[model samples]
Target: MGILDGKNILVAGVTMHTSIGYKVAELAQQEGATVIVSNFGRAMSLTGRVIKRLDPVPALIELDVTDDEHLAGLADTLREHVDHLDGVVHSIAFANPETALGGRFLQTSWPDVGQAVHVSAYSLVALAMACRPLLGRGSSIVGMTFDATVSWPFYDWMGVAKAALESANRYLARYLGPDGVRSNLISAGPIDTLAKKAIPGTEEFNRVWGERAPLGWSTTDSVPAAKGVLSLLSDYFPATTGEIIHVDGGLHATGS
Candidate 1:
C-alpha cells in the first residue's frame, strides 16, 4: 500500500504542469490519495486542462483565498467531493511584480504589501480554518515557502511575506495541535516555475543555488520539493509540526 492510501487531499494553487502543486497532486495520487485540486480566476481553466493527465483526473475547484465568501463556504463545497480531508496542501502566494518585488522593497505601497501578506501568509490560516470542519485527528496542513530567514537580491517584499508565512505556520501548529492536527511548511530552492519567472532577478537565485547547494540544485525539476510536501502530508511525520523543512539541496546550511 502507498503511504497516503485512502487519504483525501486538497491541493490548492495548481495552474501549470510545471508547478510544484501539480507535481504534488500527481504524486499524491500515485501514493494512493484521492486528490482534489483548486485554483482561481482564469487560471482555473488552465488547472482544469492540466489535471487531465492524471489517471482519474482530480476534481478542480475555484478558490480565491482573498475572498471571504469563498473561504466561508469552502467546507460545504468540499463536502461534495469527499467526506473529510486528511491533508491540505497550501501552495498559494502572490505579490505585485512591479511594486512589491524585485528591489522595490522601500517603495512598495501598503496595498501591495498587504496583498502579498494576505495571499502568501494569512491564507494558510484561512485555508486551515475553512477546512477545519472536515479535518480530524491525523489531519495535516502544508504550505510552500522560499527561505525567508535571509534576504535575497530581488526577492524583496515577497521575502517578507514568506517570513510571515513561517510565523503563521507556527501559530497554526500551536492552535491546531489540540485537535491532533499538524501544520508545517517546506522551504524549497529556486525552481524555474511560472511564479519564479515573474520575479525580476530570478536567474540570480539559480546561480546562487548552483554554486552553493551541497547536493546540487535543478531549476527544472520540481519532484524533490514535491516529495517533501508529500512526506509532510503522510503519516511519516506524525509528531512533527510548526516546522520548516528545507528541500533546497542543503543551501540553507551554507554561510555563503
Candidate 2:
C-alpha cells in the first residue's frame, strides 16, 4: 500500500494545472490518499477542469479563506467530499501586483501589506483551526514557504508574508501538538510556476537558484516536492512537527 493509503487530505490553492496544488493533489492520489481540493473566488471553473486531470478526480469545495462566509461554511463544504479529514496542505498564497512587484517596502500601502499577510500567512492558522475538529490523532497541516532568509528583490510584501507564514506554522504546531495535530512548512526553492512567473526578476531568481543549489533546480516537475508533502501527511514524520523541510535540492544549506 502507498504511504498515504488511508489518509484523507485537503489541498488548497489549485487555480490551475500548473500550480503546485495540482501536483500535490495528483501525487496524493497516486500515494493512495483520498484527496479533496479547495477553490477560491473566480477560480472555481478552472479548478473543476483541473480535477479531471487527476487519476480519480477528487472532490472540490469552496474555501476562499479570505472570506468569512466561505470559511464558516468550509467544513460543510468539504462534507460533500469526505466525512473527516486527516491532513491539510495549505498551498494558498497571493499578493496584489502592486505589493508583489514594481514595489518597494516603503511603497507598499497598509491595505496591500495587510492583504498579503492575511491571505498568505494568517489564513494558514485559520484553516488549521477550522479543520481541527475533523482531525484526530496523527493528522497533519502542511503549508508552503520560501527560504526568505534573505530579502528577494521584487518580492517586497510577499516576502514579508512568507516570513509570517513560517512563524505562524511554528505557533500552529505548538498549539496543535497537544491534540496530536502536526504542523510544518516546506521551504521550496524558486519554481517556474505561474505564481513565480508573475513576480518580476524571476529570471534572476532562477539563475541564482540554479547556480547555488547542488542538485541544480527545476520547476517543470513538482512531483518530488509533492512527495515530500505526502511524507509529512503519512506516519513517517511522527515527530516532525514545526519543522521546515527544504525540497529545494539542498539549496537552503549552500553557503556559496
Candidate 3:
C-alpha cells in the first residue's frame, strides 16, 4: 500500500506542468493520496486541464488567498470534495516584476513590498488559518520557501518575503502544535519553473548550486523536493514541526 493511501490533500499554486506544486500533486496521487488542487480565476482553468493527466483526475477548487471572500469559503468549498484534509500545501508566491528583479531593492515602493510579503509570506498564515478547520491531529501543513538566510543578486524583496515566511512557519508550528497539527517548510533549490524564469539572476544561482552543492543540482527536476514534501505529509515526520527541510542538493549547508 502507498504511504498516503486514503489521505486527502489540498495543494495550491500549480501554474504550469513544470511547477513544483504540480510535481507534488502528481507524486501525492501516486502515493495513494486523494489530491484536490486550488487555484483561482484564470489559473483554475489551467489546473483543470493539467490535472486530467493524472490517472484519477483531482478536483479543482477556487482559492485566492488574498481575497477574504475566498478565504472565508475555503473550508466549505473543500468539504464539498472531501470530508477533511490530511495535509495542505501552500505553494503560492508572487511579486510585482519591479519589486522582484533588476536590483530595485532600494527603489521598490512600499506597496510593492507589501504585495510581495502578502502573497509570498503572509499567505501561508492566511492559508493555514483558512484550512485549519478542515485539518486535525496528524495533519500537516507545508509551504515552499527559498533559502532566506542570505541575500541573492536579483532576489531583493522576494528574499525578504521568504525570511518572513520562515518566521511564520515557526509561529504557526508553535500555535498549531497544541492542536496536533504540524507546520513546516521545504527550502528548495532553484528549479527551472515559470516562477524562476521571472527572477532576473536565477541562472547564476542555479549554476552556483550545481558547482557548490555537494549533491550537485538539477534545475530541470523538482521530484526531489516533491518527494521531500510527500515525506513530511506522510507518517514519516509525525513528530516534526516548525522545521525547514532543505531539498537543495546540500547547497544550504555548504560554504561558497
Candidate 4:
C-alpha cells in the first residue's frame, strides 16, 4: 500500500512538468493520494497542459495568494473535489527580477519587497489558515525554501523574503500545533526549473553546490527534493513539525 493511501492533497504553484510542485503531485498520486494542483494567471494554462501527463489528471485551480478573495474562498473551492485535506504543499514564491532580485536588494522599492514577503512568506500562514477547517490531526503543511540562513549572490531581496518564510513557518507551527496541524519547510538545492531560470546568476548556485555538497548535487534532478517533501507528508514523520529539512545533497552542512 502507498504511504499516502486515502489522503487528499493540494499542491499549489505547479506549472511546468519540471517544477518541483508537479513532481510532488505526480508522486503523491502514485503513492495513493488524491491530488489537486493550482497556479495563477497565464501560467495556469501551462499547469493545465503538464498535469495531463499524470495517471489520473489532477484538478487545477487558480489561486493568487495576494488576493484576499482567493485565500478566503480556498477551502470551499477545494471541497468540490475532496471532502478534506490531509496535506497541503505550498510551492509558491515570487519577487520582481527587475527590482527585488539580481543584487538589487538595496535599491528595491518597498512595494516590491512587500510583494515578495506577501507572496513568499505570509502566504504560508494565509494558506494554512484558509485550509485549516479541512485539516485535522496528523494533517501536514509543507512549504519549499532555499536555505535562507545565509545570503547568496543575486538572491538578494528574495533571500530576505525566504528568511521571512522560514520564520513564518516556525510561528505557524506554534499556533497550529494546538490544532494538531504541523507546518515545516524543505530547503532544497538549486534545480534548473523554469523558476530557477528567472533568477539571474543561477549558474553560480550550481557551481557552488557542485564544489561543496559532500553528497553531491544535481541541478537537473528534482526527484530527491520531491522525495523529501513526500516523506514529510507521509505518516513516517508523525512527530516532526516546525522543522526545515535540507534536501540539498549536504550543501547546507558544508562550511565554505
Best by lDDT: 1
lDDT tens string, model 2, 1-256? 8889988999988877877788889988988899999886688988998799888988888788888787777877777778889999999888887455545678778888889999999999999878876898899999999886788877888888999999999999999999999999888887678888888776887778778989888867687677888889999999889998999988888886
Q: Rank the models by TM-score, top first.
A: 1, 4, 3, 2
lDDT of 1 by residue, 54-111 (tens): 9899999989999999999999999999999999999999999999998999999999
**For candidate 3, lDDT tens digit of each residue in 1-256?**
8889999999988878899999999999999999999889887888889888877888888899999999998999999999999999999998887565658889898889999999999999999999989999999999999999999888999999999999999999999999999999999999899888988767888779979999888899999999999999999999999999999999888887
TM-scores, one per candidate: 0.99, 0.97, 0.98, 0.99
Please report how far candidate 3 places residue 18 from its true position, in Å: 0.4
On residues 62-147, what C-alpha lDDT tens digit does candidate 4 reach at each position? Answer: 99888999989999999999999999999999999888989888899999999999999999999999999999999999999999
Name every residue pair that clashes in candidate 4: none
What lDDT is obtained when candidate 3 is compared to the true structure? 0.92
- Candidate 4, residue 182: the lDDT equals 90
What residue runs in model 4 are displaced by over 4 Å at the alpha carbon?
A: none
Looking at model 4, report the run of 10 residues with the lowest lDDT sum. Answer: 97-106
- What lDDT does the true structure give each of the candidates? 0.96, 0.86, 0.92, 0.93
In candidate 2, position 145 carries an lDDT of: 91
> How would you order the candidates by lDDT, starting with the best?
1, 4, 3, 2
